[model samples]
Target: MQGRKVAAVVAAVGALAFVVLAVLLVPWDPVPGGPLHPPPASSVFTTDQIDRAEDFAGLQRIWSWSSLAVSLAVACVLGFSRLGAAFVDRVRGPWWWRAVVAVLALTLAGRVATLPFAVLLRRRVLAYGLSHQEWGAYAVDLAKGVAVEVVGTSIGIVVLVGVARRWPRAWPAVAGVLVAGLVMLGSFVYPLLVEPLFNDFESLPDGPLRTQVLALADEEGVHVDDVLVTDASRRTTTLNAYVSGYGSSRRVVVYDNLLDGGSSVDDREVLSVVAHELGHARHDDVLIGSLLGAAGALMGVGLLGLVLGRRGSGPADPRTVPRVLALVALASLLASPVQNGISRQIETRADVDALEATGDPEAFVELQRDLALTSLADPTPYAWSHFWFGSHPTTLQRIALARRFEE
Candidate 1:
C-alpha cells in the first residue's frame, strides 16, 4: 500500500509538470507586430511588436485544458472522498451556496487587502513626489497587492465549497459568472475608483508640463480628454505615471513625484511614457486580461465535465464541488509565473511603442533607469525566474533594449 501511494504521488507530480511544460512551451503567437501595424486594428497583439514574445498559443490551449483535467483528476485521485467530506463539514449550507460564498469571500479578501497599497503608491507619488519618497509608499502598495491575492484566494476556496453544497446542478455556471465578475472588477474598476482612495488627484496644474504632455499626445494622433496629476507625496515618495481607462474611460495620469524627480524630461520623454500607457489603453489590455480569465474558467468547467462525465458520477456529495474548484484555482495559481511572463513580454512591446512614438531613445533609457531605481527593482534577475515569475522585465533588460533603439 505504501509503495502504491508513493507511485501515485510520483505520477501526479509528473502529470502536473507535463501540463505546466506544455502550457509554457506551446506556440501561441496570436499578436502581430510591425511599426506600420495600425492601432486598434486587431484585438490580439503580435510578437513582432513585442520585444520578446513566445509563439505558444497552441501550448497555452493544451496546457489550459490539460490543467483543468488534471486538477479534477488530482482531487479524486488523491482523495476525493476525503475532500468531499471536508467540504461538507466546512460549509453546512445547501452545499452549492457555501462554495460560492467561499470562493467570493476568499477572492475578495485578497483584492481588498492589496487595494490600500495601490492607493498608497498613487498617494505618495502625488503628495510627497516619486523622486523623494524612497519607495516607502510603493513598498506598501506592492505588499498590499500580495496580501489581496493571498487572502482573496483563501476566501475563494471556502466559497467554492459552499457552492457545491447549495446548488450542485448549476454551481459551475454560477461560479463561472462570479469569477468573471471578480476579474472584471479587479482589472477595470479597481484602477479607477480603488486607485484614487490612497492618493489625491486633480487636474494637472496649468503649466508647460501639462501643455507639453497634451501636445505630444496630439502629435502621436492619440486623443485625450484630459491629463490629471495625483498628489502622491502625501503618502510616500516614488515617481511614476500610467495611462488608465479604455476607449471612453481613457485618461493619462501623472504623479506629482514624476514632476519633482526631474528638472526637465523633454516633450519627447514624456511622450514616450504617454505612448507606453496608450499602448495598454488602446489595446484594451485590461479587458483582454479579464476575457482571458473568463476563458480559463470556462475551459476549467469543460475539463471538469469531461472528467466527471467519464466517471459516470456527478458529485456524489455537493460539498466535493468546492474541493474540485479549489483544485483548479490552485493549479491556476501555480501557473501564474507563465502568465506573468506573457504580461512582461507585452509590456516590453508597450515600451517599444513608447520609444517609437517619441523617437527619443535617450529619454526612454533615462526614464527606465530612474523608474527602476525608484521602485528598487533589481537590474539583473535570474533568467528563469524572470521568465516564470516576474511580471515586468528586469531593469537591465529594459536599459539594454532602450540603448538598442537609441542606436
Candidate 2:
C-alpha cells in the first residue's frame, strides 16, 4: 500500500514537471516593448464608445456572476446530492449505456437550468446591437450546440468508464492518451465538419483584398491556399476573424460583416485581421494549443485516478460518475486562470506577428480601435475578471502595443 502511494506521488510530480517543461519549451518570440503604458482614454476610444462599452461591460459582469452561481449550484447538486447517482442507479442499461444516459441527463438538466441566464444574455446582446440573430435562429443554434455537447460528453464518459473497468490500475495513462487524441482529432476536423454547421463558408473572391491576403500569407511563409469568408453577418454585426485547423484542414475565416463594404471596416483593417490569423497559422498555434491540452488531460486523468483509488471506487461504478463529473468540473474551473494566461500570451504573440508581418502599426491600432468600438469591449476591465476570463490582452494593451511600433 505504501509502495502504491509512493508511486502515485512520484507519477504526479513527474506529470507536473512535464507540463511545466512543455510550456517553457514553447517558442515564444518576443515583442518589442519598453515600459507597460496604457493607451490614452481619449485617443483609444470616443466618449460615446466608452459609454456603450461600459454598459456592455456591466451587463457582461452580471451575466458572468449569474452564470458562475448557476454552475456552482449545479456542480453542488451533482457532487453533494444523490440526484446524479440516483438517476444512474435507476437507469436500465449496460454500464457503458448507463454512463451515457447519466451524462446526457445531467447535461440536459444543466442546460435547462441555465436557459434563463442564456436567454437573458442573448437579449442583452441584442439590446447592445452586437447580435442580429433572430430568436428562432438563436433557438436553432442552441439546440445544435446542445446536441453536439451531448454526443461529445457521452462518448467521453463511456470511454472513461470503459477504460476504468478494463484497466483499473492503468486506466489513467490510457485515458490520458485517448483524451489527447480526441483533442487533436477535434482540432483537425473542426474546420471541415463542425464549423460549417454554424456558418456557411465560401472562398474569398478574386479581388485586391484576396490578393493582399494571399500575399500576407506568403510573406509569413504560411501556405494558406485560400481565405474563407463566413456568413457571420447573419448572426453577428461584430467584426472578427480567426484561424483554425492544421495542415490541409487549416483555413482563415473572416466575418462577412468585416468584408461588407457598407460596414465601417476598411481594407486596411481586414488586411490586419488576415495577417494576424496568418501569424497563428505560421506559428502553428492551434497545434501548440492541442499539445498543451493533451498534457493537461494526462495530468487531469492521472489525478482523477488517484482520487478514485483513494475512494476505493472503480471508474465503471455508476455511483462514481457523479464524483468524477464533480471533480472534472472543479478542476476545469480552477484551471481557467492558467489556461487563459497561456491563451493571452499566444494571442499577444499573434498580435506582434501581425504588426511585424504587415509593417503597418498604424493600421493595427485602427483595427484594435474598430474591434473595441464594434464589439463594445471595455477598455478597462476588472483585473480579477480579466485574469480569470480574458483570453486576449485587454483592448487597451493591444492598442498600446501597436503604438509601440511608432516608437
Candidate 3:
C-alpha cells in the first residue's frame, strides 16, 4: 500500500519537475513593459453588433455547456454503475481483447449519449450562417471522429492495463512514463495521420501571396515546408489559419474561406494570421505543449493507478476500464482552468510574435475585428468563464495589444 502511494508521489514529483522546466523555458511574457489595456468593446463594435454577438454567444454557450454536462454525466454513470462491468463480463475473450472491447463500448456509449447535443449545435450553426454542412456530411464527420477516438483511446488503455498486469506493484511509475510517451507520440503524428481523415489539402499555388508567405516564414526563421490550403470553406465560414507539426513535417495551413470568402481578409491579414501560427512553430510551441501534455498524462496515469489499487480493482481487469475512463473525464474537466490559462499565455505570445513579425498593426487590429464579428465572439466575456474556458485573448484584448505593440 505504501509502495503504491510512493509510486504516485514519484510520478507527481516528476510532473512537477516538468512543469518547472516549462516555466523556466517558455517566454511567458513576450511583450515587454506590462500587460496591454484593451479598449472597450463598444470602441470597436457598434451597439447593434455587440447585441447580436452577445445573443449568439450566449445561446452557443448554453448548448456547449449542456453538451459538456451530459457527456460528463454519461461517463460517470457508466463508470460508477455496474452496466459497464456487466457488458464487459458478457464478452468472452482474452484479457487484452476484453480490455479493448470494454473501452470501445464505453466510449461509444458516451459519444452516442452526447449526440443530440451535437445535432443541436450543428443546427444552431447552420441557422446562424456559421455552417452549411449537410446532415449526411455531418454524420460522416462525426463517425470519423468516433473512429479516431476509439483507435487512440483503445491503444492507450491497452498499454495502461498491460503494464499494470505485468508489474502490479510498480505499474504506476511504469505506466506513467509509458502513457506520457504515448501523449507525445500522439501529438507528433496527429498532424500526419489523423488530420487527413477530415480535410483534404492542396499547396498554395504560385502567386505573389504564396511568395510573400514564404518570405515571411524566412524572416521569422520558421522552416515551413509548404504553405498549404484546406477545404475548410466546404463546412464552415470561419476565418482561420494554423501551423502544425515540427521539424521537417511542419507546414502552414490557411483556410480557403479566409482567402476567398470576405473582402475583409486581405494579403496582409492573411500574412498576420500565418505569422501568428509561425510564432507557434518558431518557438516550438507545439513541442512545448506536447511536453507539458506528456507530463500531465504521466501525472494523471499515476493518480489513476493509486485510485485503482486503493479500490482493489484488478489493474488488468476489463471491468475497470469504464472507471478508468470516468476518472480521465473528471480529471480533464478539473484541469481546464489551469490548462486554459497556460494556453492563453501561449496564444498571447503568438499574437505578440505576429505583431513583431509583420510590423502591420493596422492589418492585425482590423483582422482581429473581422475575426470577432465573423465568429460572433463576445469581446468581453465573464471573468470567471474566461479564466476557465478561454484559450485565447478576447478579440478586443488582441486589438489593444496590437495597438500597444505599434506604439
Candidate 4:
C-alpha cells in the first residue's frame, strides 16, 4: 500500500510536468517562415533565422511563465500538506525538532545578513550611468535571490548533516569537510573548495606542454603560470580545461579526460584549449562578466520595484512580495537567453585572441573541431536554444571565425 502510494505520487508529478510542457509548446498563432524582422544584408543568419528566432522567443516566453506557475504549484502542494507530513515523520523525533530549529535559525541569519548588503549595493549601482543604474537595480534583486538560495540550501545541508550524524544507517555524509563545504558554498568559493575535493593539484608537471603554454603566454605579453591537471574523470566523462583564479591562483586546469581518453584529444590540442581559456583571463572576461551581471541585477530590481510597486504591494508586504518576486525571477530567467547570446559574442572574440596569442590558428581550429566532436555538441542547434543555454559560438561559427583571424 505504501509503495503504491509513492508510485501514485510520482505518476501525478510526471503528469503535471507533461501538461505544463504541452500547454507551453502549443502555440496560439502559427509562426511564418518568412522574414519576421529583416536585418542588414551582412548579418550572420538570414530571414529564416529571424523568423525562427521570433517563433522560439514566443515559445520560450510561454514556457518560462507557465513553467514557473507549474513549479510553484507543485512546491506548494509538496510543502504544505501530506507530502511534507510524511517527510517530517521520517526524521527521528528530537533530532527532527533540532534540525527544524537549525533551519529556521539559518534562514533568519541569511535574511538579516542580506538586506543591508543588497540595499547598499543597489544604491551604489544607481550612482553610475543609466545602464549602470539599471544593472545595479538588478543586483539588488539578485541579492535577495541569493539570500533565498543560500538560506534554503543551508537548511538542506544542516538537515542532511544532522540526519547523517544521528542515523548513520540512513545516509552517510560520505565526503569530508572539503566536499561538503564546496557543495554548500557554490558560487564564489567553488574553485577553492569543491575543486580540491576530487583531484590532487600540485604545480604544473614538468613537460613540453608546460613550456609551450608558458611560451605562448609570453608571446602574447601575458604572464606565465602553472598548468595543473585535475582528476575530473572521477565525477564526469566530460573533457574540459580552463584557466581559473584572479591573480596568484590563476592556473590552467586540464581534466584527466583531456589527457587520457574520454576524448582522443592530444597534449597539443590541450595547449590550444588552454590558450583560448587564457584569452578569456587576459581579456578579464570574468571580471567584466561579474560587472555586467551586477549591472543587470540592479536594473532588474529597480524595474521590478517600479512595476510591482504601482500595481501590487510594497516591498515590505511579505505575503505578496514573495509572489511578485517569484514572477520577477521568472522574467529574469527568461532573459538569460539574451545574455547567453552576448556571452557567445565574447567567446568568439576570445577565440580570436587565442589564435593571435598563440600564433597558431591552425592548431586552434584543430582543437575546436576535436572539441566539438568529443563533446557531441550540435553543429547547428536551434538559434533560440543556443542563445539561452550555449555560451560558446557554434562549432561552425568558431571555425569560420578562427579562419578569419588566421587570414
Instruction: Estimate the TM-score for candidate 1.
Output: 0.60
**How do the residues 43-77 of candidate 2 rate in per-residue lDDT, one tens digit apiece?**
77778888889988897789867986787678668
TM-score of each: 0.60, 0.95, 0.97, 0.55
lDDT (Cα, tens digit) per residue for candidate 1, span 242-332: 7655556566787776666453455556666777876665566655555555555544543453444344333435444444555565667
lDDT of prediction 4: 0.52
Please list the Cα RMSD from the true structure of every candidate, rounded to 1 decimal place.
12.1, 2.0, 1.5, 19.1
Badly placed stretches (over 4 Å) of model 2 are 1-14, 17-21, 24-29
What is model 3's C-alpha RMSD? 1.5
List candidate 3 stretches off by more than 4 Å: none
Estimate every model's Cα lDDT from 0 to 1.
0.55, 0.81, 0.85, 0.52
Leading candidate by TM-score: 3
Order of quality (TM-score): 3, 2, 1, 4
> Judged by lDDT, which candidate is best?
3
Clashing pairs in 3: none
lDDT of 3 by residue, 106-130 (tens): 8788888888878888888888888
Ranking by lDDT: 3, 2, 1, 4
Best of the two (1, 2) by lDDT: 2
